[model samples]
Target: MAKVDAPAVEERQKGILGWIEKTGNKLPDPVIIFAYLIGILIVVSVITDWMGVSVEHPVRVNEDGSPVVEPARMLFRSELIEHLLVRMPTIFTSFHPLGYVLVVMLGAGVAERAGLFGTAMRAAVRNAPRFLLTPAVALVAMLANLAADAAYVVLIPLAGVIYAAAGRHPIAGITAAFAGVSGGFSANLFPGQLDALLFGITEAAVGSLVTDWVMNIAGNWYFIAVMTIFYLPVIWFVTDGIIEKRLGKWTGGAVAGSSDADDDPDAPLTAGQKKGLAHAGLAVLAVVFLWLFLTVDLVELVSFGAVSVWGGNPPLLNPDPALEVTQQLIPFFTSLVAGFLILFLAAGVAYGMAAGTIKTHRDTVEMMAGGMKDMGYYLVLAFAAAYFVEMFNLSNLGIISAVNGANAIQQSGLPLPIVLGLIVLFAGVLNLFVGSASAKWAFMAPILVPMLMLLGISPEMATAAYRVGDSATNIITPLMVYFPLVLVFARRWVPDFGIGSLTAAMLPYSIWLLITGIIMTIAWVYLGLPLGPGAEVGYTLPGAN
Candidate 1:
């Protein structure tokens, strides 16, 4: 029997992407990189301060509601030390994703540890019709963002298993799943922690200029929902049509001995697993009904004074007191991450009990604790990230960069489409350096959000563009937190599969996803689409309003 030909060495070094992985892998860890950056920011801040570099506030207002144009001062040693010594604790605690990740993980951790997520994913793909397998895996991968990190851990490897069982290339399944998981990170069917994290940064940036402007958590909801629709076919087609064809067929090797009784496609679902799945379905429905009960104001119930939680507030767009609350999404939006927490927790508890992975309430607590334990490294990363963002803000470098960047774009006299594309491209470039979405947004929003707003772009629109660039390059970048884990997943199937091989496999997906992202961005902006509920394509200065 002939051995399957390994991917060529020349292919690994074929172009810019290969060079990127090689150079990128040689860099220090993301935490160390951020620490070094913090040092550089201090020195640069002092020099820029000495040079007296400053920019007049574009729309900052004074106490009496007049437009305040005070210059933004650069950071100096005294202020830096004060921030480090006094506010360091606040800086780390206030990092937006810290609480979000922890809270959500408490539930997700239980779901994962109880074997609920693993069984659910296995059942999802194991039962998928042969004709629909590609899209099924891709769709599940996209939706798995709700589980955050678990998708990468559970789904990607499972995809490889599913494909190998079906006699398709296992790497193709891995590619498809990774594309959806990371490449399409920003695209989701609904708003969750990401919305809360990104828009909180937007709110902060907007507050820097328009103090009264309200930041809706669902500002990017409509766009992201639509993005999911647009991105699905791209991954489906790229993986099934393009990637699979290039790789020929799977003449199996390391993947041969990788069968499991738990995930075996031939084994029929037991009565208990079936019952657990039914209970899981009911749990999801219960969550849906509960949220609906909280979000909607039914006249029948309200007439009897059994008030809904959101009944007191008016519509987001129109605030006339006499008008009834037509649509209130803030309470719903704010609760989305928590809603996921509840949904997962309830479902996991139900499934765990029925399937015997969790027998008691103590088991559930242990599961949640296990989830928190898994977040140890993330907690450390968060501390470093929070300081980097807060310090950068204190240095005034973010605002200075934004002002100069906005001025440069304004002077370019280019079309808005070209300008927006450039912003996306710039963000893609930045993704190569800083891998954390929240940290990068925290640093960039002070500049990009306000800068684009001054350019007549909405803060939501700026955020949408930033997300496209941020997510598009995630698969190919070695610095992404999960990149090495993904490589390990691949090597299990092909022991000789090095970093270059994994990157080489994923490079096509990255390129096509980015191009599709750029097109989606240009179309959405040029077509003047609303980003989400109450989110517009343009902004008005509060003073002007």
Candidate 2:
């Protein structure tokens, strides 16, 4: 009887895992997650509305203008319009934002397609000392995200080759890069498209609870940068200690795709690409210098619907005269553009020097066009994601759930640090199954951000907490879209290493990072340092009380 029950239990476990895998993928997807999560919110909202949760909205009477703040009963299913699903289709479709992201992705795709980015990674690896390989790879991978997809297709694979050549496991190389790039998704010295979109979502959420709420892109910058510092050392230790130790030793020959330290006879980097690197680097440095000079001098980049270099708080950060809070976070807001510009400038110059095609001014323009062509699929994904979010918003379901859930959390006796830790852990566990950062954020942000706001935690603080959880367990989760890719890279050294094998190797890192992160959050709360500009370490009203 015992033996028979054991087999049955095993089968049940397997069944559970299968179900989990299916749900995980659907949950982190923009199209699916937004739909499901938002649907839940709407359903919950209706229930709560039925139970008598109401807010008396204040608005001034106007003859011609629609009142700004109208009474909003938490929407109920019955409250939904008859054309609801019909109306939802257009809203969902509208969510796919293709333009702004593409403007940046096109340039990114060009550099990546031109082999400039490939050359850059190889070049960095070849030049870097062995001891520094872990740190360098981690740092570069985190920074390379500024170029969008460049890190995924380019840096990840290249990492395996570089490590294999350096007498280490190729899989370990991929893991390190993957860890830094995807796991460190929220950690960037410079923000990118993701930042802009998230801030927009946050701004909208804030407005729902406050009048003229401003959520600048840079609202979470300082926290992100600090988190980067928090993450780097942890990653370095994991790569150097566990991964490399497991691989044993590197054989003499280079791996398949490596640029070959001795110079590849097939497709070599040209002097032009080298020159491009020099130029790109210079351009990036110049931009950095200019920014520092301006910021330190208190020059305003955006201010009160105007651009002014010399002024007060609202300089370049706050472009809306009506939204003053944005000014406090301008650097975070504009960094995405800065990130794109830097990647293009660097890759463009590098490509120009290596390919020699960029020697003249015309070649550069063509390179820009070339970049656009490579961005074809990414544009599609972006559009789909946009539609997903927009659809969820129009439903107003996510808002309802967030309000109720946040209200529940606010009423609970949980400590503030406890809340942060739990969110991080939730993100970590969910991350293992789902593996889509933005999708998770989209589903979570509507509820988590507002909920935390009710707890007197700033959205920036909530964003930071979400980031920590989402990134820490990335390596161990088989569900991460990039997880299998890392495994394939790992298999180069340990031929039999499969999903279980990879997870075992990476589990220690994931666990330790989580522990450390929890510790850090507690320390941060105790210190009472601001998470960002005016972002409190404790609870406060979502808006003016």
State which candidate has the highest lDDT: 1
Each candidate: RMSD:
4.0, 7.4
Model 1 misplaced stretches (Cα beyond 4 Å): 1-15, 62-67, 72-74, 77-80, 212-215, 251-255, 299-328, 491-495
lDDT of 2 by residue, 260-342 (tens): 44333124556666766676677667666665654544333334436444544333354445755535455644554545655
The residue-level lDDT of candidate 1 at 39 comes to 84
At residue 373, give the lDDT of candidate 1: 94
**Over the stretch 1-545, how does candidate 1's per-residue lDDT look in tens digits?**
12434445564654777667667768776678778878888788778878887776677657896655444345556766786789778878876667766777788888888877767777777788877888888888877776777789888987887787788888888888999989889988877657766776676676555666655667888888888888888888888888899878887832445555663565777888888888888998999888776655455356765654455632222334564442345445656668778988999999889988888899999999999998897788778877776776676777677778878887888878777887888888878767888767866787777778777899989999999999988988878988878776676676677667777777788888788888988888888988887687877765555
| TM values, all candidates | 0.88, 0.76
Which candidate achieves the best TM-score against the true structure? Answer: 1
> In model 1, where is the ten-residue run with the lowest total lDDT?
313-322
lDDT at residue 367 of model 1 (Cα atoms): 94
What is the clash count for each candidate, in the order shown? 0, 27
